[model samples]
Target: MLLSRKAWEIDLREARKMRHSEVLGCCPHDCQDGCSWVAHVEDGKVTKVVGSKEHPFTRGVLCAKVNDYQTRTYAPDRLLHPLRRTGAKGSGEFERISWDKAIREIAFEFGNIINDWGSEALMPLHDMGSAGALQRRALMRLFHHIGASRLHGSLCGQSGNAVAAEGHPISFDPETLAESECILLWGANLLSTAHHHWHFCLEARKMRGAKIISIDPRRTRTAAKCDEHISIRPGTDAVLAAGMANVLVEEGLADFEYARSAADDLDACLEEIKAWTPDHVCEVTGVAPDDVVRIARIYGAARPGTLRVGIGPQQSRFGDVFVKSLSALAILSGHWRLPGGGLSIEGYPTFDNAAPECPELSPEGTRSLHRGQLGRILTSSDLDPPIKGLMIWGHNPLVNQIDAETVRQGLCRDDLFTVVIEQFMTDTARHADIVLPSTTQLEHFDVQGSWGHCYVGLNHPAIPPLGESKPHTEILRFLAKEMGLDEPALFADDETIARSCLPDGFDWATLNQQGWLFAPQPRRDPASMGGSLKMSMGLDGPEDLNVRDPIAIGKLRLLTVKPHYLLNSTFANMPRQAGQQGNPTLEMHPADAKSLGLQDGDRVLAQNGKGTLAAMLRVTDAVLTGTTVLEGKFWWTANEDGSPVSNRLANSNWTEGGQPTFNDIFVEVTATSGFADI
Candidate 1:
């Protein structure tokens, strides 16, 4: 037996297989591009993660935040086990605990809360931390089973979507951008937010002589590259879109034949636009009347003109109005008849799947709370049991939410018991009573739907759980069994869920090997539906165009934008990513800085009725005279010296569509310590 050469060769083959291997996965972060990636594992450790070269949409590209993902997974400060708070809340002091003990404690606390205050007292809050369908839905299945207060998502205004329904919302494939004649980046910071889409836009510009225009309050990175940038006033996007609609109709540039065939309310929309003349729009929007006419002509004359809507415009108090206005503009342009000639809102592809939320398990009339009002929900007397137990995952509200001070106060309550599932001790995690370690994308099984392009990705676990950490599904499974609950859905295997999410008859093993599959774009055009598009113009008269606020004298509209290197608070802690972002600075127009008697690099305080924030100033003309820009999703501890976070001054008020009005905030700035010594 010892001399058998065939036995030795068989053993060597097994060793070679184990030593080097590649696992397919999808990027879990909440980004427009749900990129497919390959994890190279050597000796049971992930050596590197690279974008899949075979993915048509990803094209072997990964954003700066995710290119070095192995570093993030193996970061020194990554949480490796369950822990219990050992000091005051928000102190970041915790002691390691056993997995069995951790599960038992959670079971006991959750049971106690339910018995004392009914299951509605328990609230589970989450955001798009991981866009993977399984990771997002696992905890929801547990919460629904327990009849906890449901979190009504606040990522966007559904009211705006409801208005979009009047006319079929057709999101043409971004790949078709190569065919577009005129591309209007309306409120879309594509170069910063969705860089993949910008590739196609650039191709159109260079290949077909396409005209690109950027319409925004600040001259964003995308705007800097565009042929023209229209610096419109904040909250006036609806006015500009309405003006363009008027010009399209008045100048006889509108596709009257297409409009009559595709839209049922064309006559009514005509009446609405009559009041939104170019001059009146200029008075309200601060855009030149001639520029409005010119842009309108460009869009109207092009056979395949298109518009791309962004999250920025819908964060205003009248977000629904903005969506409706933009929708009307596109409908009147009659661009949907051709490829790349319609409004493009990033959308997820549909799949044959089970209900991730398991709404069927929820009790009748279970209370639902909005995420925008988290502070109010926790502190309000109107809530009967008042959120006794809060479980958080997939979100860091303290850094991302509006009214930071109020959220802080709510988290600091002694009576409240909070459980946080995280990979790192984020600002919100530090305040939790129990911190459970969670696995990174490299250690999980997931499926992803792209909001940026038409592709679906598969993720296979590349390595075992690093320590006592587990995937969201495994964590929930352990807790579910510990609590003596027996829901079939709660115990479903991750691979099964992932496989069911794919199209029927798709080969799972083949998909795992290939990394991704092309999801064909659906036909959403009105002509295909055999019906006319019916939509409200969202404006009635001059009064509807007015967005001016009678604020305190020196107040300027504070515009908070997303950083290019960070997705919300996800990569804010990485040294390399943080270094790229540098210190957070408030950008003020030269005229505004001069009016306030301040210079660039000066330390200033922005205060409003809600709260105040401190930051260094950069005097630049990128912003308009009456506005200031601060781009970030920085952690609460971003400033090493312990200063307030950027969202402290944001208004918690909801938009007309029930979304956070982070862009509608108005604040006054004053020199705090004058120019920094450096």
Candidate 2:
């Protein structure tokens, strides 16, 4: 019963049968918007999937990447059965194996590793690939029982939340942004990433005539629609923020009384901003002094203006300072005190229900691995008991991690017994000793929520597990049985687990009946969190740690941004998404292209001390003269000779907040082929 790879639509018979019922579910991808969705199921097959129009924020619209999600579940290349590798690692060779045998092998290997090198050698790697409450966390429970090493870091690659939001990530009730007089979308491509929220921004203009400004180095689609687009230099977000504060205080637009109540050392903050003159800011941020002054005056004068922060700034050398500086402007102008004038850095941890209690089996001193530094962690020789069993679930490290070539090399090690739980045959899955098929979101039962929205979602099993794939809980249960352990917690079904994680006194039946559950939260004024405004940006010391005499270091700063079509390499395997997004090109300013004797469409090599990647050059003014842009996690697009794709350009050096400095890299560009007519 192999499905046609090219088939894009369900047959009439399947469709008619599925029309009888629609199951409620939610998209479990790594997006902040955990959009509630409806799966039209007929004859045990999902005919179609669509967003819930009833869901307030998603509003029935789905992103292009997820709109064709049914195709992904039924993709011809989907790993339908358990596979045991026969050829070399990363060779894409395997034979289908029975579930019992697969589980037995995994158990035996894991037990051997624990017996010989202690449980710490058995490393479990998991992340937000399947973000359902009972989906990804199922693996965590098992690892805790085994005492495997802990993975403590974020692949989101941003520490702005820690820097700006006073350690509590809050978005100012996105629904209230429409009342704002002005909106600043800093480093966020709202049109692409936060598409749904863009509608509210438009409404703000119609309702209140709010001025919308986009601050980015590139004139992104969102920037094009913005009333103003201010191009700032890469890694220089802090400078502009400081300069804005300077003008606000000097022009008497700032609310001194509000700052006095909310921020400690208010006078010290004001005195610091006085030195951040417009001319000094222009030199560091690459923005015209006039534009800087104009934006500051417009934003500072507006009451209850909203400030939206994105993950882009966290990729810089001083992302913490950059985000803190932006957050401070709200306090300086007393904008946080206004209804629509607060800041929304991120909306994670909005859900009040997360059960952190896990059975502690490992010793207290087990090593903790940073998820971003997988390459360096795997290749390191200083470990007490070297990582023998590497189990990757819900994350594609080969394509997404820093120094991916090194990750590839490390995965190929014969001594490492690797296991990957996945749906598609990803780059990381190809390197596994065993590939275990996992159920798609439509075929799983779980409770889900969103960081972007306040609605809770119910993911009913629209159909039975696809092919021989099992739901996450079932898989873990089978493994526990094979290992001869009968922990009642391990055998608990999805319903039981979901119920346990729900907020106290929450009724599952009622929540499902309503099709959504709204979080219990009263609207909070920003001034209520007095003295919690993160005043320190850590700017008293070295701000530009990456900057050195240009004579020795690479000149151009590198920024690998999220692709408009791909979601962290997940959709790269889809023809519709991957085909639409062709080869990865390095976009550079025309001035820099001319200086390097390069022309548009020329094959160029971008090299830094970390690694090098080759792509066709695009000479455009969309990028700053001293910086280059490359859309990332491009794994499906492969070169003839095996090489790293997107992560090749990024180094694993983290920021002050344990975030990957994906954008802090500096690269030297050279024309690999025919030169330009310089």
Candidate 3:
């Protein structure tokens, strides 16, 4: 209430004054390119935004999304107050409620669910929405104390992290890429996906003459800018990677001694790749055998070639397998030791030490959930009484999940009580039993680190939380206290949580002033280099070769791929962004389109066994025949009577590691006449 009073006073002042200086802070959204922006406030209103020149990561640059902050921050459709559904579930009908009543209602329902079904039935789904470390960790601590069903393995980087853990000691620093002679932009588009990295890539090109080779199914902005683009079939990255390793071995381009030393079972691994010759791989990946060999040779011979592995390569059914194979290419080529010559996987560097202290919920014991199967978890009676209570934060499962219709059904279930904390009335929020207003990055203070860049940024609050919105940390703290959780210490302030993340003896004041933290250099020893090769290569063995089972036949293999623009549906609700790109549509190759009697821009019914969706067709050669590509950010919308559109294409039974593989589903497409343009 005090904050609101202050905000009102600021607003009144803004009406009297045209402009006023407001210190800028970093916007720590679930984006690879964390932007630095300064707010112009007159009274209490934000009148303008500009790039922060002092911010090292952004370097005074702001993306289109950041430039449109006014629309996103104070949009008419924003959840200005808490709301409880008054109409039937999924009806987009809600009545405004005060924060006091909202929180009390949520607590009462959640407590009742816990009392009746036990903690395991109450599932807390947390992702990148409120990325503040204290906020996320507090939820984990609360769930731990209350015995809630915990979400595990990470919907985003489980496979990539597994590869990084198994293969390298640390990711190749982005700064080192500028020194490379050659760079492989593997399965990722840095220009659109990781915008901040694009600046570095451009510098590497201009300064170091770094030759860029982009390997992806679509000709993205990065692909268009690269020196060469090798378009390959989706889900065949592993075969191509293995083929490269084979070429390195056969042409004597590999450091045989180093391979043997790095990996304990180097000889066995080499032998395993013998079957991955260019010809064999070409058959599977649809890439020419000679072209594969040529690319491999270029990569192997290039002095200090950097391999930047993108997250898209690891989104398939065999995501972990592909990541591991790619890592092997780097090791076999002996690229790991040189600067800018290693794998780079995208992820947020969380300082949360919950893993080291809480071994039960640590990274080691984390379970992998199928990001696509969110709907089934909510709706299925077979899930042992089903998840009774749900808490949605950071992520919008309705838009990001593979088969969205199923998720809608699950959310609409009478038995499933849902609470969504969000900035806007997202598709997922519309189905929630209660929706709580959440603060934007501009309203919170925290530190952020990028997987691409090494610099850690400090996010200072630039404006008061808008309307009735609350920072996620405060929400979790209040919940913890109300629930009487055992470890109240876990719900500490952002400053305390930030301090805990740093290594002991670090100067907090200096770090805040600098607005960035560089990871400490790993102590290097010449003695350690001798066994590095052996340690790296020792994992390859005959048994390890057959660890993964062969891909099943006859079933439709759906791969829910991310496009360059939207990565996991974060920017879907931004009006300016949505206006530019419109709603996400499905893309298929011309040959496949004709075979299915679908035309470009035609409304087609796309269905797997579980569900179907009607989407506008985008016919292009960019996608390979028989494979369909759809943008991953379309919120499931209902018909006039309330039947959801986007959810129609989801498969309920298709799950992997307790998560659904939306991308691994086999679907059939046909032109639909009655559908409206999506």
Task: Say which prediction, candidate 1 or candidate 3, comes out ahead on TM-score.
Answer: 1
Residue-wise lDDT of candidate 3 within 472-588, one digit each (tens)? 778877776666655645466667756766666666676577556655344221123454432222223212211121122222233455544444666665656766665446778
Better of 2 and 3 by TM-score: 2
**Leading candidate by lDDT:** 1
The sequence of per-residue lDDT tens digits that candidate 2 reaches over residues 1-678 is 766754524675566655668887888887766777888876667788898888887789888778868888898988889999999888898999999899999999999999999888888888778878777776667777778888776767357545533543246567677888899999888777778888888988999999999999888889999999898877778878888888887888988887777767677787777777898888677788898889889888887788887888767667777777776777787777766777776554234334422535445776787777888877889987888999898899888777787898889989899999999888899999999999898788887766665667778878877789987788888898899887677887777777766667776677777567776345554466665554545554233534322213447877787778888778887889977767778999898888889999988787877677777789999876677888756773355432427577676677777777777678888977532321
Lowest summed lDDT across 10 adjacent residues in model 3 is found at: 542-551
Q: What are the models' TM-scores?
A: 0.93, 0.92, 0.86
Q: Which lDDT values do the candidates have, in the order given?
A: 0.81, 0.77, 0.66
Which portions of model 3 show Cα errors greater than 4 Å?
A: 1-19, 167-170, 347-350, 353-373, 379-386, 484-486, 520-567, 638-660, 676-678
Candidate 1 per-residue lDDT, tens place, 1-678, comes to 384798899989899887989888889887777888889998999998988888877788888889989998899999999999999999999999998988899899999999999999999988788877787776788899999998774655454555655656747678888889899998889877877788888888888789999999889999999999999888888889999999998888877777677677888888888888899998888899999999999999987898987888888777777887777788778888888888787655655424566777888899899876888787788889789999998989888787777888899999899999999999999999999998899988888777677777888888988888889988888999999999998898888767666777776677677878777557576555444666556675434322543133557888888788887788889999989977778999997899889999888888788766777899999888788888877887787543447667776677665778778778888887532221
In order, what is each prediction's RMSD in angstroms?
Answer: 3.6, 5.3, 6.2
Question: Lowest summed-lDDT stretch of 10 residues in model 1?
Answer: 542-551
